[model samples]
Target chain A: MTKPADTGMTEASAPVILGQNSGPLSRAISRLRGHSFAVANLLMAPTMLWLLLFLALPLGVILVYSFGSRGTYGDVIYGFAFDNYLRAFSPIWLPVILRSFLFAGIATALTLAMGYPLAYFIAIYGGRRKSIYLILVMVPFWTSYLIRTYSWIVILRSQGVVNTILQWANIIDNPLDLLNTPFSVILGLTYGFLPFMTLPLYASLEKLDKSLIEAAWDLGASRIWALLTVTIPLSIPGIIAGTLLVFIPAVGDFVTPDLLGGPDTLMIGNVIQQQFLSARDWAYGSALSFSLMAILLIGIFLYVRKVGTENLA
Target chain B: MNDGTPSTIEQCEDCAIRLEGVTKRFGDFTAVEKMDLGIRRGEFFSLLGPSGCGKTTTLRMIAGFEEPSEGAILLDGVDVARLPPYRRNVNTVFQNYALFPHLNVEKNVAFGLKRKKLPKDEIATRVADALRMVELGDRATYKPDQLSGGMQQRVALARALVNLPSVLLLDEPLGALDLKLRRQMQLELKHIHKNVGITFIYVTHDQEEALTMSDRIAVMNMGTVEQVGSPEELYESPGSRFVASFIGTSNFIDGVVQWTATEGSIVLGDGERVIIELPEDGSRPVTVELSVRPEKIRLRESGEEVQPGQCMLRGTVRDVVYLGMTTQYSLHIPSLDRVFSVLEQNVEIASDQTLWVSGEEAILTWHPSHNRMLPSSGA
Candidate 1:
């Protein structure tokens, strides 16, 4: 299919006429094409600069400050110490960190159990209205996350929607305490992160070859057994992806816990926010956030190892 | 079909699979209409038709993928039409060889056995034996993505065969392979069927493959079965014009029922007449339409001598196609207003290497034994 004149002018045979070529700019462009690394670096320059300015610089400052101690006036102490690190890991803060992990884990599990069937139904059985179903799944995300969390408050308050309906129906003698509980916080997290779980799972399930399921059924597998053996195993990539998307953000989610949680439902994110904004203990705040990041990194590495790195990508 | 076929397809108890007035309709569009068929036990029965002719739909109904809109799909005397595919004692080899990508070859083959909760050692030995049957023993740990298309197809076969179902349904299973591989797999499949001895219900649009492998083939058209018989019976005595054109090349000529199969005269549209005859098969053709297979007709020099009672026509050679094994000549007969093709073997190699040239006048002749009447040709 090559043009006749271009056959002899292949890359290996083409003369690199730099001096007589057009102008210096064109010559430089041709030279740049020869070195793909230059083109790649040029393409990546904006993203690299953005990350360096916004992400790396802040993280570097935090790393340096995390080793420093708070002054008497809670300001200007520039000496390295293990005191902040030890305090970040102390018994006083341990409960909040552990609760953060536990809440995130439970919320992630709940979202997975809820999202998988929705994704399956939309992807497989949605048929001609699949797009509408998918849009409905994502309807909650169209509103602001803050507004959505606030709407949960309106619903879960003592005399709000559920309590009003139940009281009118006389299901219970008194209004139930639905707000300011771990359950409320967990429910909020699950609702907010549902689309995050479902979209990836839908992508995986939608691409699944339906004939594989038919083949399984033909091979004597009952419907439930076929789903267990065939459908779930093939959609592992989506499961892993959705879990990562929901679990990582849910762990440090301060808004849900702060809005819907009681005093007993405090998380590490709230503790970090208090140290930075309320107490103005920046050094300890940096220490706590750094510890959180390190723990998350370790947990991700362990999780990826158990699931096999191949499944994640 | 408008022309009446036998209404009573005798209910035989020994049939491995039977469709009784099974009609499948998607909305108003009927995919399969009142398909009554009987497949004998341990026979390689093929549902052959062009795409959208309901061959695959009929196979799916038998496999219980879709329940019949009307009537029963009986598997060995028991109506299993309403049962789900998993409950039916039959398996299907999907056209695309839908092997589970997550499972290796051994695990894929053992999947059906595992679903049955077979013991550990039995599952292991059976999986190995199935792999060996498909000649994929060395590739047990290889994922489906790792194997070539042909090998993956073999794995699919082993996966279905390991279940030992009473009937195996193949929906054009070799359709995805290259021609050479498809030919090889076709022979291997026939060999496997011989050893397994289970009734095989194969659905394919390829008439040649059906003729090669099937013990009996049911030719379907539109939404109904046109005819069903052995390969020889179909090629020799097609029941209708559709089967005649679909199965092989046929030059259909409208004729009058002047006499029985051994003697007849056809009155063409332009006041011309043609003579034909063929050996009778114990009954008179119920219709007057006649046809002859193209290969049964031979082309000779314009003035070649011919035996008595041999039908002859003169036509100009319009196109010559040297198809490696046989040279096909399309002759334009102005009197008949049709282009009749004549196939001749390419066995003679002359020093000049000459062949049939366009614009050459030639005489085509064939014994009337090749002339046959269509049973339902009146329609």
Candidate 2:
């Protein structure tokens, strides 16, 4: 970039004048620079159009519908009403919201508790086997998520491998009640989101300066103290990233609950899915979809505000 | 218990660290060969070597970051060979200044004190003292990323110093800084050494840095100590060709010993005889390489040259580099392809291209003392 401009100025082929002419070549190059800026702006036009049309338009539609009335046959009616939001906060809906939060929170916490050690082990001690370990973490992700979740049914069912093993081991007299419960749902969600929790945390932990830990050790901190004060604190961004990844997706997840959870432990996602397909209430479904999206958006907003946007390039 | 511990600490102050035939090996590669080194109380010692020469491994062994494959390390008269790094009373200022990016400067400096569970006020006072020591008191509120390289290095130093460890291990602490800042910090480090009076084990590949600041330097090569001496001693009388070459520029002349006199001097195969003191119970025809420092060799009027003494090599100036204070001459001698010579700027080398080059060849003389016998090349 610097060389071409110097060449242009150096290869002077103009009539000698009191002042340099700033000739047609220079003008053309300057015009080319202007055209390049315009081209760059033109390059962004489609993406701008995409955000405005698809993203902003859909969000606008949802926002409008959130405030509007519901028609008799479950269609959005274009009249202002706060009933859906009010209904979202009603005593009847509180249990569902609380249940979603509890499930997601438990899943997030469990994912972190399990994933962090795995990530830390991979980063610190996996050595030449690091890629193989990482591949193992990603293997479950390769199988279709639904298929993996369904495979849990095979393992958790009455005659499944887990029950058979337990029976063989004499730990249980009968096949245990493992599937179709909140525990199963939580287990399924944790299994599904393990990779999501591990990869980013692994990335952050891998990039962590080993010298910081050494510095901690130098400061007379025990290994556990060093990890708690230095390693864990430094890895918070990864924790936040992993938590949001697990929690947001698990909150809106219907498949895990549908396959593994009992009717008594049904989450908001299962209810929303039932509202759309079984109940055939499109208005309430849209409202429920909007609600899930709102929660996810808020989670993402907090995540970005706290860790992502503050440091991410 | 406190009285006994204090007495123990007092009695153990003579040798800050001692390594007994320590050897570190990673797989088949020997990072540190069987080595013995002792660091005295409150001394600034540098482990000087090129990259992969195991200077860092030695320092890490001392810091308890690495365990020796053989032998033990005694810290303050106590066997700390198997102790974890956290259990050792040693701190390391890592090369990149490895400050916790999430912590502000004050918090970074205070990190060690926090780990020790010091009183809050004590931690604050010590952190302030550390920051002030590094002249970074005003930047306490800034995070590591907010500071420049020099400031970051100071923060690392402060973090290490605040702990008041029995020893401070600086692993190329200024290696990451720019040249000007590096020089500035080198002096700053020397001042810190003077102020703190703690045993410092600094590791660096830079010869000049090691020469400038260390109380004693251990010159290492190929996972072995080449020589150990003060800067002047190492530069003036290197024990091997490696040390001679590594410490400063030198001209090596390889020749066959033709004859020996009662004194150590000998005659070469080409009838270019020179004299040097001989070792007791000398053997004959012992082939040896002669090491000559560049600055010690001078050019003079050819015919008026002093009688050839211990060693002399006829060489011509091939090129000249005119540095502001001193001039460097690249001389080409048939013995060795090239030899470098540093001379004062006023020592004019006239451009009469065919000028005879010889001087009081006595300064070029080598003694049995000066001649460092090295393994003969497999010619």
Candidate 3:
């Protein structure tokens, strides 16, 4: 879009200066030369329009709704009130929030514990097969995340593949209860987010200099010591990135918990979903979402400040 | 432990590191082949070669980073082939410095010492002393990336030296530096080796770096050691054609031995005879190649008085390269159809008079003893 304007400016300026004309056309050409701001704004128009319509406008509507009230007959009434936010902190909803934090935290930890070694293996020892290993890590994404989560249910449910195998092997007289629990929720969250954690970890680990590990080992560090002192410290950026990638979405995840969790394993996402769709309380749902966003932003802000922005991957 | 004092003559006789027929193979390709070498106590020994010539593989074997596929490596008279790098009594200064980006200079230097679980006071003192040795004492709190390239290299040196291992293996530690910084670090490294009195096994592809810093050098080629000698010995009396060509620039005159005598001579392809001093055994090979250093050849005007026992070749000056300290004249002999380089020192000659015009007849002469014979197997 800017190409013709640039050529026009060059071609027009030459004739205007050579002819020494100060007419309206020449003045307009000079003004066009000084209006690069307008050109830049034009270039940014598509992204600005996208953010305004899809991101900022939706966020503004949510913010406004969080302060409004819920009407009878399941409709939103336009009125300023802090009742939704106040109710979010009440004893009735505190357990749900706490449960979501616990599930997200455990899932993030599990993902990190599993992803770090896989990333290390791919980065350090994969050799010429590194791309193959990376593709294998990403192969789960070829199927829908929802289908992958459902497959775990097929494996973990009583009388499913795992329980049937265990019974046929005669290792258990009774099938253990593995599905519809907090364990299943955390497992589903971890399985869904494992690739998210592994990719950033791989990126950071791949960027780490192999010589540093050798230098550490040369300086009298054992293999484990070198991994702890040199490898782990150098991959801190990957760790932070992987944590944020897994933890943020895991906290706000509704589908995994809704599909896998029992009645006793309710999370804040389930509460928000109920408020918005079943209870028809959009204000309360917005309040819950805003609170989650605020808490997550604050936590991320503190973490980045501690680790320093320059260390971010 | 010895307070940085020079070792006694008795201690100097001990071999600190020994490679007993060590060979390293990566699958089908051999990186190092049956290399037997001994680095003495308090000696700065260099493994010099072109890239992929097994110089680095030899160093890695000694440092225990690579296990020799055949034979063994010994450190201070003890076989350490089975030991890991941490268990070996040696440290390596990597080419890129390999300073830990997460650690400060002090912590980097103190890394090895802390691994030994030394007392806090001793670790501090030694770390400080090492930083002072590298003249980077003030940059202790700074990370590796915060320092300049040269400073980071010094921190790597200090980090390895703080351990005071029985041997210090340096794999082209100054290879990353610019020429000026490299020269400075070469002197500093030599000085440190003298002070610490540790056996230093250095590896480099740069022949000049090997010549400048090593007390003795092993010139390697194609997974084998071509020749091992002092700098002067390697330059003056290279044992193989590979060593002669790799160490320094040499003018190779290919010819067949005509007759063996006190003053032996070889007949060139054009039937011109050049005088050379044969080996004492007097078993002259059917064909031989002679290496003459460019600096050793003198360019004189025609019909000049030739000293006795001096061989002379007459040719026309094809090109003149006026270097700062010396002017190189490339003489093209019509009979040989080759250009012989003769480097003449511009001691009294002014810069304007140094340019020897092309197509000028010149006589190239060198002492008979300076014509070093190379091995029959040509490189």
Those runs of model 3 whose alpha carbons end farther than 4 Å from true positions after fitting are: A1-49, A307-313, B1-13, B267-272, B350-355
CA-lDDT, candidates in order: 0.86, 0.78, 0.86
Fnat per candidate, as a fraction, reads 0.78, 0.82, 0.82
Judging by lDDT, tell me the better candidate of 1 and 3: 1
RMSD of 2: 7.9
User: What does DockQ give for each predicted structure?
Assistant: 0.42, 0.45, 0.39
* Highest-DockQ candidate: 2
lDDT of 3 at B210: 93
Please identify which of the two predictions, 1 or 2, would achieve the higher TM-score against the true structure. 1
The ten-residue window of minimal lDDT in model 2 chain A covers A1-10
The DockQ for candidate 3, computed on C-alphas, is 0.39
In candidate 1, what are the lDDT values of residues A1-313, reduced to their tens digit?
A: 0124443455434457644569887878978887888889999999999999999999999988888877778784877898888999999978888889999999999999999999999999999999999999989878999999999999999989999999999998898999999999999999999999999999999999999999888888889999988899889888988998999998998999999999989999899899888888889999999999999999988986777654422
Question: In model 2 chain B, which range of ten residues has the least summed lDDT?
Answer: B1-10
| Residue A165 accuracy (lDDT) in model 3 | 99
Give TM-scores for every candidate, taking all chains together and pairing residue i with residue i: 0.90, 0.85, 0.90
